[model samples]
Target: MYRRIRFFLTSVLFLCVATAFCNDKENPDAIIGTWLNATGKGHIQIYKQGNKYFGKLVWLKEPNDEQGNPKVDSKNPNASLKTKPLIGATILRDFVFDDDEWNSGRIYDPQNGKDYKCFLRLKDSKTLLVRGYVGVSLLGRTETWTRIN
Candidate 1:
């Protein structure tokens, strides 16, 4: 009887450890990948840094402007940063997963050189809903980004 009880407790402990190991192996965030923006003009690679998520533009449909010069963040509010190229710029930053979405992030629009409060939600494995709001969520705009992979 003593051996049987010891064996049973050991088996349960092994199972609990195995379950935790498996959970650690499984990724909690399904949003890590390359995603194409709604306009189909740019591709951003979403990656995890620490406990947060960030996205940066990797490719652009039109890399160069009409003058054949590489597109830049010309409209950036900061005159010192206006010369920075837009192709590899970090457009999304500091997103923390909360509830069913990634919240407390900011998305920058290189076109107008403005930043908006952003939240991200995965509609499906292949679709992501990116919302950028000014004051409230209802006052924002949502864009659908399709996963590349």
Candidate 2:
């Protein structure tokens, strides 16, 4: 009877410890890392800030223009922002985890200076599906982003 009681107590303790280690909110940075864009044109480093997530340009395929000058957002719709450099630009913003995925985020495309409603769903530990749309999520396009490291 004493052996049975010891076994039961050990099992309960094990379960409680496991449950605490497997919580989602506790791992807010589960998806924080460097990821490559679909076309292999950019590497974005996702980071967390005050319970929200954002991504910025860390590396670029072509960092310089034809004249060997650092690249700028020349295509930006806003004339004032057109001169802003591309490196370290905040291209993703305001992401929160929800329903086993990260939702309610915005992705900014520097190529066209357009912002799209986007959400991220991890396909696995090494892959992520990023969907961007205008209105409803059903009308969006999904892009596969591979984890950089």
Candidate 3:
């Protein structure tokens, strides 16, 4: 009886550890691939920077430029930012996953050279909803991102 009880406890413990390991492997915020902005207005590529996530403009349908060059955020009002180009500007930055959502992040709009409070939520394995807000969460726009993979 003693041996049987010991074996049963050991089996249960092993099962619990395996379950926990499996759960950790199933990360929903594994947005570590190329994604396209399905908003029809522009295209973005999301990539990882160290332990966080960021996005940059890979392509734009209606690029805001006069000479067909990629437009910078001239309307930023910040002299330093207004001169930066749009192509390689870091639009999404410091996105960390919390539970099921990414919060307290910032998104830069190259067209306006403005950074807004950004949060992202995975609608599924392929779809991500990215929101950019000013002061309040309610005052934000949600854009759907489709995984390129």
lDDT of 3 by residue, 69-118 (tens): 76776877678877666666667899887787877799877655578999
Instruction: Put down candidate 2 lDDT per residue, 1-149, tens digits, no spaces.
Output: 99999999999999999878865434657779999999898999999999999999989999889999889988778898788889888888999988668889999999888999999888776788999999999988999999998
Write model 1 residue lDDT over 29-141, tens digit each, in one string: 77889999999999999999999999999999999999999999999999988998898899999998876789999999998989999999887778889999998999999
Instruction: Please give each candidate's TM-score.
Output: 0.80, 0.80, 0.71
Candidate 3 overall Cα lDDT vs. reference? 0.77
Clashing residue pairs in candidate 3 are: none
Misplaced by over 4 Å in model 1 are 1-27
- Identify the superior model by TM-score, candidate 2 or candidate 3: 2
Error of 3 at 69 (Å): 2.8
RMSD of each: 6.0, 3.7, 5.6
Cα lDDT listed for each candidate: 0.90, 0.88, 0.77
| Model 1 lDDT, full chain set | 0.90
Q: What is the TM-score (0 to 1) of candidate 1?
A: 0.80
